[model samples]
Target: MKIIFNRLYADYLMPSRLGEYEAILRQARDLGYAQLAVRDFYRSRDRSPPGRVLVHRHDIDSDLRTARKLFALESRHGVRATYYFRLCTLDIGFMREIEAAGSEASYHYEEVATFAKQWRIRTPDTLRARFPEIRQQFARNFDSIAERLGCPLATVASHGDFANRKLNVINHELLNDTALRQQCGIECEAYDDALLRHIDIYISDRKHPVYYRPASPFDALGRDRAILFLTHPVQWETNWIDNTRCNARRIIEELAWRTSASC
Candidate 1:
């Protein structure tokens, strides 16, 4: 019966609306989870507090408008979260607005894939040969984003490009290099295992549902365990149909932009 209900909720009830998210936040509070912006979690590492912790993270894949809405919703509940924006989607105004609303902002980078596509470097050999150049470009892009934000970005989340089969590089790999971390001044990765050490559970609304293989937040609540919830701003629509339509529109827009750029 519980499994049936979870499936139904995943299919019909989730990729929740703002109101649903608000209710979830309230429930987390009631369950004794303290909300922390990613930066706050790092700062409190030495003086660990009692009770569970919830680190809310948003990957702003597209649509700054919707991201702003999520930030406002979190603000209304007096909860803070981290927002990571892609270089192609950076909006200084929106970043500043969310920052003012008490959310932390950082980069969502896809430098390796971008470099691969730009150079048409498909093979592993080609990618290996151009590794240094790719790293240089990554640093430059990071600097550009940080300069625009007018502050150093402490954390970054890798943006995955599954469509790029030629360059199968994961963006987070850049952080694995100690020199790159020191040079870029990145204090943490959004999905770093080091950070996960403090978290007892992790949940996400990936692919438009509360993905449950191992477990979901619904399963972990009231267990006195720290949780990390990752969500994409594009998923939290009023309903599944609307979310699908919005995503379709974004794909069309992206295709049109690429076509126009090529011409």
Candidate 2:
């Protein structure tokens, strides 16, 4: 089951393993591309670098430990990347560590969508009607992030939840409201038009069956003059041994979820 899971989900889970991620960082560095965290990149828009630039952004969907591992790798390579962590993965100490390492520490919000699930909001009309409450919840969540981390919150990325897809709602909708953004005191959104306008190529290693998507990390390597490399930390491991072990747990958890859902 481990092998089958690994083969079927290649780039989706643990294929962009730590070793591979390290190699990519080295390659990008060798090709004259210095890593820029998302917050830094957005904040320094007017002073954008002329040479090759790589914005390596990670969305912490599942594991904080894996994020720490990725952070260590980037620190060793002298690369400053961006990490947008979900509320579920927030660890104040680790976030402080990331900031100290010269990387950007930010949020990965999915509150609006998660709330929609809890409220049983399935239709667009219902979503709109309850949006005011959901928006308030969004700001409150940001407050928690700031208070818990005891630091300033700047840039954030919205997580795409399964609920959002099923409801035809975009998670970033919370950030879209100017008033809500002001309430949260947010600086930038990862998907903000201003930030994305400068990216020459957008590459993401989201969940997908190995065969459903191409598997080469090099697919965008060194080819684009400016690149936004988005990845999930949970989908990476240090090596095959770690990857297989992690996959085993993932499989069992998945099976259990399916079993319970079917009941």
Which numbered prediction scores highest in lDDT against the true structure?
2
Please provide, for model 1 over 1-263, each residue's C-alpha lDDT reduced to its tens digit, 9 standing for 90 to 100: 87766544643575546676777788888888888888778667558655788888888877566677888778878898999998766898888776777778888888776765565555656655677787888889889888888888888888887424434567676567889889989888877876878888777774434433346666676774788888876566534554456557658644643554321
Over 4 Å off in model 2, which ranges? 1-16, 207-217, 238-263
Q: Give lDDT tens digits, candidate 2, residues 58-166.
A: 9987666678888888999999988887876778898888888888887889887777666556576677677788888878888888888878888899898656776
For candidate 2, which ten residues in a row score worst on lDDT?
206-215
TM-score of each: 0.80, 0.82
lDDT of model 2 at residue 208? 33
Q: Single out the weakest 10-residue window by summed lDDT for candidate 1.
A: 254-263
Total residue pair clashes for candidate 2: 1
Candidate-wise lDDT, in order: 0.73, 0.75
In model 1, the runs with Cα more than 4 Å from the true position are 1-16, 163-167, 208-214, 238-263
